[model samples]
Target: MAGLPQSSTYVSLTTFRRTGEAVPTPVWAAPDGDRLVVWTRADSGKVKRLRHTARVTVAPCDVRGRTTDEPVEATAVLLEPHEWRQARAALARRYGWQWRVSYASSKLWQRVTRPGIQRHAMIRVRPA
Candidate 1:
């Protein structure tokens, strides 16, 4: 991994409130200092649930292929437009990851960029 970007591959833990249960999704993510950022559609359930609770947990995978279901406790918050841009760039640089659904897509660009539909939220997880 000589020329590859040196960064941790983290498993982002985000939760949501279901009708009568709790839901969680593990996403590949990038870390910036104490902040862990992830991008997703604003209409996503994760975004909706986060508004209700900002507490989150983030954990980096161990080199030995080991990971506990429970994550390190941390607080999370949303990112703004400008910050989102920076985070996106950082993510691309670190992991070469791209969003399959983008606000720039012709199919539903408007919906993706809408204030709260696909543009209302950004994930920012921090230390507890």
Candidate 2:
């Protein structure tokens, strides 16, 4: 599968429920070899859905989750803790300060609001 557009800052990640309903979310995506990596909260709906099924769809999109390109059928794998660290580092390199600020802000917000929220996870989506 071809890599995402160079100019794209976000991608719409679509994960499926057991009932096959699609849940789409806009997320920051970074190229990693043959897959695209995304960092998200561990307890997020997408992560929960991925636990039941690896099938997913990805497409260039705006922050609102509106697709800007045709979606690509893919399989999403949840990374282990160590791999999550590598993915986060790679994403930080690709996005520079933006990733850092967003990550820190999210952590701060979660601490303030959720108190005991789970740590974040990194997901790798490869072409199906």
Candidate 3:
């Protein structure tokens, strides 16, 4: 866990499917105490995969999903909505206006594409 980048802007979040396939994605991550907070779409494949498996691996990566460091074994959990405020606040602090603009844009897009339902979900990752 100590090896995982605490300040990395993009982390390759790899989640396991029920069939044990590894799906890796490049996502924004921000440190929150002992864990990292990741914001992603609610219906993303990674979120669906995590619903069935908690095993995960994370590494610092570029915008293209190419990892820049060795991956660290970890566990991930879907966070409850009540925890989102502070989690998102952490991201906003770390990413500054970019985070705000990106998130607001995502929400707006979601309203147009998938209205009347939550579009974003938060995942908390801890080094195992």
Q: What is the C-alpha RMSD of each candidate to the true structure, in Å?
A: 6.6, 2.4, 1.5
lDDT, each prediction: 0.59, 0.86, 0.91
Q: Predictions ranked by TM-score, top down? A: 3, 2, 1
Write down the TM-score of every candidate: 0.64, 0.85, 0.91
Per-residue lDDT tens digits for candidate 2, residues 57-125, read 889999898898888889999998767777887788779999999989988988988888657888988
Off by over 4 Å in 2: 1-7, 107-117
Task: Report the Cα lDDT for candidate 1.
Answer: 0.59
lDDT of candidate model 2 versus the reference: 0.86
Instruction: Give the alpha carbon lDDT tens digit for every residue of 79-114 in model 3.
Output: 999989989999999999999999999889889998
Clash count of each predicted structure: 2, 0, 0
Best candidate, TM-score: 3
Q: List residue ranges in candidate 1 displaced over 4 A.
A: 1-10, 16-22, 60-70, 97-120
Pairs of residues at least 3 apart in sequence or in different chains that clash in candidate 1: 42-118, 43-117
